[model samples]
Target chain A: MSPGSGPHTAERRGRPRDSGTDSAIIETVLRLMEEGATIGALSIERIARETGVGKATVYRRWSGKDALLVDVMKSLEETAPPLKGESVRNDLVSCLEFARRRGLAKRSSAVLRNVLGQIHSNPGLWGQYQETVIATRREAMHEVLRRGVHTGEIRPGVDLDLLSDLFTGPLLARAVLRPDGSLEEGLQEGLSEQIVDTVLAGVAPPPVAGG
Target chain B: MSPGSGPHTAERRGRPRDSGTDSAIIETVLRLMEEGATIGALSIERIARETGVGKATVYRRWSGKDALLVDVMKSLEETAPPLKGESVRNDLVSCLEFARRRGLAKRSSAVLRNVLGQIHSNPGLWGQYQETVIATRREAMHEVLRRGVHTGEIRPGVDLDLLSDLFTGPLLARAVLRPDGSLEEGLQEGLSEQIVDTVLAGVAPPPVAGG
Candidate 1:
């Protein structure tokens, strides 16, 4: 049915949402971000203009800029593949491995962290990003830790949430801070394993075990 | 004899180095940084202009801008104070405690870290900062780790350098990344104890004791 040719066609203005347009708009936003445009600097209209799409097309999908950014984070999140349901230790490595890879993949993971941090100036955007994206990943890690606790892989008394940060911090500090950039490249190759193992076995001697 | 009247005064065309002028110069650099100046944006000429001193006066103190910044770092380092040397665990707590305090004191430690990271674009300046300021701190931490090993407070066979990062990483990640900004304040107040204790006591159940 030719849309404008008939009254029925005119009434039926509906068309399937173009996934290609959605993808192009999303990529344009990411490209701008990687080029050093912060989340604070980007707008839906600018993104639409850059992507060569109408502003209405962008608004039709996401409610606003923050909504658009949450989706951008989601796209970035997808780059970190899903964790395998292996042993708890193995899963922990997977989490860090993803972080390590992300750190290496980006010129400065700070760009991403900066984006997250900058949005704090806007409570609505920050809360939305935190609740939707950060909380979800945090729960995933907590779920792994909780499962480990049930299996006795993790100790009973330790905090699962804090445990997650402990496991994740060193790799993150390296990636985001760039403090250790001068260390020999080979030193960081097995970082995921190195951190997880050292931590699981306390730094103090065995007698001080379970301290 | 009056300094101007004496022949000796003419020969000694000097006064004791004015510590006041030095403080003024360093404070000006810090104030500018807090106002969002990067290391690359700073110069001896600009600093002297801002501090209301002559370029020659600045040159007499620090040979160049990087030399001046190394002193700025030294001033910031002074704020952290000396470790108590009480025990490995106690010293570790002191280290994280200082980090926690530093994070709280500044609006952004990234301002400090960013200054460091941004300087990496220049190999010479970065190397100077690394060798002088960062290397000295690294050795200090390594020395503490070595002393702990000697006292049997820390375990043998661990890399002292990597171990230091593991101990400090969590509190730092929260500080630098701001991921945990939304968490309860009390949660982080005890962070130094939380990280050092959790890390000292292995997270894995006892059956995996030394793994």
Candidate 2:
């Protein structure tokens, strides 16, 4: 079956489906969620119809609706751009801004809540989802914060884990609590700035060497 | 037929049922959740049988499982005592201690996650839940932080709302994440100290405040 160094080897015998099949499926799921199709309401048939893929293909890759949605969410967890500036304030602003820009989409929040709901009932999925998004995000921020501490920009005694949670908690709470399923944009930024200012006041200790 | 200040009254006619009814129903729901009844598995019949109350009586008070569970959760919300202490740290320690104790219960986290799942789907109940418990707890903490700021113990610019959320977020994330469904005891004191120290460092302006 090995064709010699040609596009022919990549091509399959079936009618050529786009190589972007995975992206298409994720997009379809996101689009469906954006349009208010909840996780409980989503079905493979609907996704297949939306993406123009056959049911058999989706089943082959993902066992069911929960699996498909989980994968779609995982795909969104690509490395968020790194913190932009050297200062703690700038780093936090960048972090919050990233959350604001990427985290607050109505569709994403709904899907997140729906997925969270599923996790409560399904133990197998909980660890994977938590590890992929929640833990991964925290780990990245922890690294950035540790760097800040090492550079004498942050105080020595701060609990990096607790501080990181404190930094992001309000935004997450508001997103989770609101029934309209929209993050109040102005509120998010304002709250982010407030938290940053507060933490900076506490964490950046007295000058040590390079004054 | 209203009683005219007599020993026998219409209110007393069903007084026996009314007196023990709420407690009996709540106990049933709590037992089910403790026994690992998924939110979907809770039923009026189950409660009726457990409480030995007629199904009609259960329906009369609570429209369905959602309403019944909501009422049951409301009863538990009374567990978080109001913040009362001489200082912000004292108040927060007390408040967080409440969460720590609650988190330590074998069934507490599961019960909470189940309620959260219900909250995500049921908007009315969600609002009610937040208004009764989440909002109350945060507001009390906000008052504590606000006092701290006024007394110049906390920085003037501290975002009280966001700070409260920061204090609570990790506890919540941990509550949902842990399979054992309780917080490790050390984390309670450790996180409390971390939050107080972090916030104080920021809010206590330098001898000559930095730009």
Candidate 3:
């Protein structure tokens, strides 16, 4: 259904809208997604039924399943706190910690895994995910690295793009491959510290000879 | 079907076995897997039909789909060359280079991606993958790291498990998330070197004081 022609949208213009139903639909979508349901598998009818709302209610907010999924992913991105700290190391640790907490959460990793599985098959959803989620996170990390270089805390020639991957990739790989329920709390904390320390040490500028 | 009861096994004991048929089945399985077919989707009936063999032929070789997949993954593991070099850095670079070349190969990444998607869902299949694929690779990398520590190339207290992830995770992540086709050749080479250099610099023991 086109966004402009949906019956619920027309009703909204004539009368007050039910915000609760809107949230209910979104929550249902998130829960299903976290349970490993793909976008193609989640029909609007199923979502509306699961949410105990009419089909028109969902169609009013989202034109289709892809639109709903994009909205849900955006909500996740919005919930993530921005990265900021006194030093580059602190900033990186905090940013990584943010990712760790999210990864450790029940359903979050499953939701991400489901998305990663189908990302190649669905370019439109992938593009939205990149823009709303990945691009924003990368931009925050880039700012920290840029500031570190400006302050001479990091070597001038370090490739920030590669460095970013090095810093985040292990943690992400662990989350996806091993999942959180299997790991001890101490191990998780240790891994975070280890990754941060390694990156910091790697990027530190060499001391001037004979100083 | 039990392993000992298979017609192929019986034939092996009585007369010359059809090595060509065995290879043909494996090749068809790999091709289907690389095209994003799931274990559940690849029934013995389908595989036999695709290979122009009877259901009894496939059943005689593999007890079930999981067994077949495990065998396929083992075949992939056997194909990976062992890491060897004059120094720890060289060993690591070579190891990662092997992974890069494999990732860049047509259809290989797709097969890996397809497996990764279902790893969390199927514990039996996952255990086989871990034993046959992940453990072997990690052990080789561990040997190189252990030698590095003994030679004082890497610091003594470095966490080898976490270090292994740090070394290989970015490459794997890039293969799955970005896929090598989209990246330029120079970028791939540069990334491999950057990862190696950053890791080597990060893990080197502190310079001797006042040296």
Residue B39 alpha-carbon offset, candidate 1, angstroms: 11
Local lDDT at A17 for model 2: 48
Model 2 gets an lDDT of 0.67
List candidate 1 segments past 4 Å from native: A1-18, A35-68, A79-86, A107-111, A179-184, A203-211, B1-77, B110-137, B177-184, B187-189, B201-211
TM-score of chain A for candidate 2? 0.77
| Tens-digit lDDT string for candidate 1 (A97-163) | 7667766754344345434444434446656656655577677788888877777666676776667
Task: List the candidate 2 regions with Cα displacement exceeding 4 Å.
Answer: A1-58, A178-183, A207-211, B1-24, B31-57, B82-84, B104-108, B119-121, B177-182, B185-188, B205-211
Q: Rank the candidates by lDDT, best first.
A: 3, 2, 1
lDDT of 2 by residue, B152-190 (tens): 677676556667766776666566544444367554557
RMSD of each: 8.9, 6.8, 4.5
Q: Which of the CAPRI classes, incorrect, acceptable, medium or high, describes model 1? A: incorrect
Best by TM-score: 3
Model 2 chain A poorest 10 in a row by lDDT: A1-10
lDDT of 3 at B3: 52
Please count the clashing residue pairs in each candidate, in the order shown: 0, 4, 0
> DockQ, per-model, please?
0.23, 0.36, 0.46
Q: TM-score, chain A, per candidate? A: 0.73, 0.77, 0.85
> lDDT per model, in order?
0.65, 0.67, 0.73
Minimal lDDT window, size 10, model 3 chain A: A1-10
Candidate 1 share of real interface contacts: 0.37
